[model samples]
Target chain A: MKWIDAPWIELLRIALEVAATVAFALSGVMMAARKRFDAVGVCVVAFVSAFGGGTLRDLLLDQRPFFWVRHTEFVWGILLLSLAAMLFMRQRHFQPTERAMLLPDAIGLGLFAAVGVDIATAVGMPALIAVMMGVTTGVFGGVLRDVLCNEVPQAFSDHRPYALCAFAGGWADVALRQVEGTVVSPLLACVLITAGLRGLALWRNWELPAWRV
Target chain B: MKWIDAPWIELLRIALEVAATVAFALSGVMMAARKRFDAVGVCVVAFVSAFGGGTLRDLLLDQRPFFWVRHTEFVWGILLLSLAAMLFMRQRHFQPTERAMLLPDAIGLGLFAAVGVDIATAVGMPALIAVMMGVTTGVFGGVLRDVLCNEVPQAFSDHRPYALCAFAGGWADVALRQVEGTVVSPLLACVLITAGLRGLALWRNWELPAWRV
Candidate 1:
């Protein structure tokens, strides 16, 4: 309720939330299509991937009436997107290239990381926990998506710096918490850092060393 | 707090919760061993399998300090069990048969379904939603486990009567809500119905027909 009521800030938050949702939804849809899942499976997977992380974060914060439930428009947006995407892909026989997915996915991860940090901080979570929550928010959706698609989560196994990027951005958000009214918004700064790191990682083929036993 | 304060009933609930946790943890350990996961991976997978469903439920209900966080004993139980099981498995080179997993998994499913229904009802959820939540609690851990282990969810693909059994049992729990002073405890009745149906289904090799799209 309070979240839905915060005027201009709330409007900006909603916009970011939509962006994050669309990014994740696109990722989910692409995966589902790759798996050749039916239309129903595509929509379900897309919804879960788009909404799962924020839902988990909200529930952890004990926020009632989930974000999607509160803003049915988000749900509608995903549904419409999935429908359109599915139809377009079916008609055009187009497969989304991995490179096509990279930009939105990176942007979504950054937006979600910032949003997660902001929400957790608003709920008075400890700074470290808030940062962790931010990473969870950014990465967990993809984890759910990958899991549902019967793959080891890219976050856990691919050794890419996905979660690490979010982690760094979260720490940045926390460090810049005191610097209000700067030239760039701290939230925007967090987003930029995360997206930049993820993009750079992709470009440079950066990876965390895999642990083997 | 109220859940932990219901005296005798709470004690029974706690016992059931422990039983379910151990059952699920064992299944997780068995799955991890089958995958030949390292100790850390084993423990992480086991924890998620054992706690994921209830954690999801608590978050949805806006219950804070998640069930595992509040009942640290459950967390300890899972950790210790995972460790012991891993050591025993490694030393003996033992792989648990699917049959070994069947009984406990079924029992845990039933118990968790009842607990889910009870919690949802207590929170004043609609009967249908509560029943759905019950099935979710009963099946989602295994879903998470299967997904993490890079397999399609047995509930979705096995076409088995697993979740359907839980759904039926949950509906029974809801239906019997008005029946007070019954010979059978409603909770126990729900458990028996779910476990019985699941057992029979397994014994008879019953499955839902796969829908082709």
Candidate 2:
């Protein structure tokens, strides 16, 4: 029996990434409709924000031909959601605030980072590079999102603790993985750390020190 | 003494990618502004559409540290442009039907695919993966741009001659490199093929068959 596989957790991670993809896509559509952008532009933004981070993670890890290609379901979901958003946008714009995407987004941040770090570490990347990869996988998607949307990322701009929260969770997860003779699972460590940090940051308004030029 | 580097052509390639990046970013911002999206959403859309493809290609190729991280200037350019687009949006909303992006985007298609193929081949990737990388690098960004903006990618949409042109260019580039010792510059072959295909596509109204779901 493969005692270490953690299928349930993996499933949850997949589900979380999928949910985040949907939320992120909706975010793009909502913005596009608001801007009165043409159909092409709206769809482009939706796809990028939804898939950008995972694609980056997979690519850096040299895991081809990529997730969207393998999982027609993910691509299909995006297509259907995009069509729905376009058709009923005037009457029914998606509302992330109203929906419960925050927890899933938080899950995405942690899992993406943990998995990124694990891959980087396995490949013998330097600790700093691995950490950076972890953070990049975790937060770059949101940063890309904000930049395309035409603003400094809220975490980076408002001195909020977004990436840092992910970073902390990543650090703890990575560190806990090395405890002597402990069966501390990477997935469990990743989930707990990510969720914990994200929740704490939200509750306490934890923030990073802002750069002032 | 590195005498055969093709300085002018390399410069041209870099220049084209840069121009395409700006044009792509602008298109993103234009779309966001027209949709009346907030600043954050606009920036997110612009950044992802512009950087999403090449970034994905690099990461997938396991080009460590990633090109964007190494070439921080690209991020700076995208940032500056996204900011400008958001601020000046009310002054000038992008009209996609006006065709401001067709040429720059084509240049991007040619240059990015060529670069992606070059990078993949150098890394010893198999030919099929290399071509896929080239195509992904060339066209995925646009796919991404459309998705984020909440519309079906023109590549997968009705009668849009978008990705097929890029795909032909990438395959042609790969074939050119496979010639007898191919002392002939691979990138030059890529450039000619891509530019020709993309131009012919626009002029001749070439398009790929869309999925019939």
Candidate 1 overall Cα lDDT vs. reference? 0.82
Give the lowest summed-lDDT range of ten residues in model 2 chain B.
Answer: B89-98
Query: How many collisions between residues are there in candidate 1?
Result: 0
Q: Write the per-residue lDDT of candidate 2 for residues A1-213, one digit (tens) a residue.
A: 133356764465566567657766776666666656788767777777677776766666566777678777987788788777788755665443423546666766776777667656666565555655677777766666665766545434444455666667667666766673332466457656876788787778765432111
True interface contacts reproduced, per candidate = 0.19, 0.03
> Which digits, one per residue and each the tens of the lDDT, describe model 1 over residues A1-47?
35434677777888898999999999998887777665555765798
What DockQ does candidate 2 score? 0.05
lDDT of 1 by residue, B20-90 (tens): 98999899999988888888888988998888888778767776787788889888888899999988877
TM-score per model over all chains: 0.61, 0.53
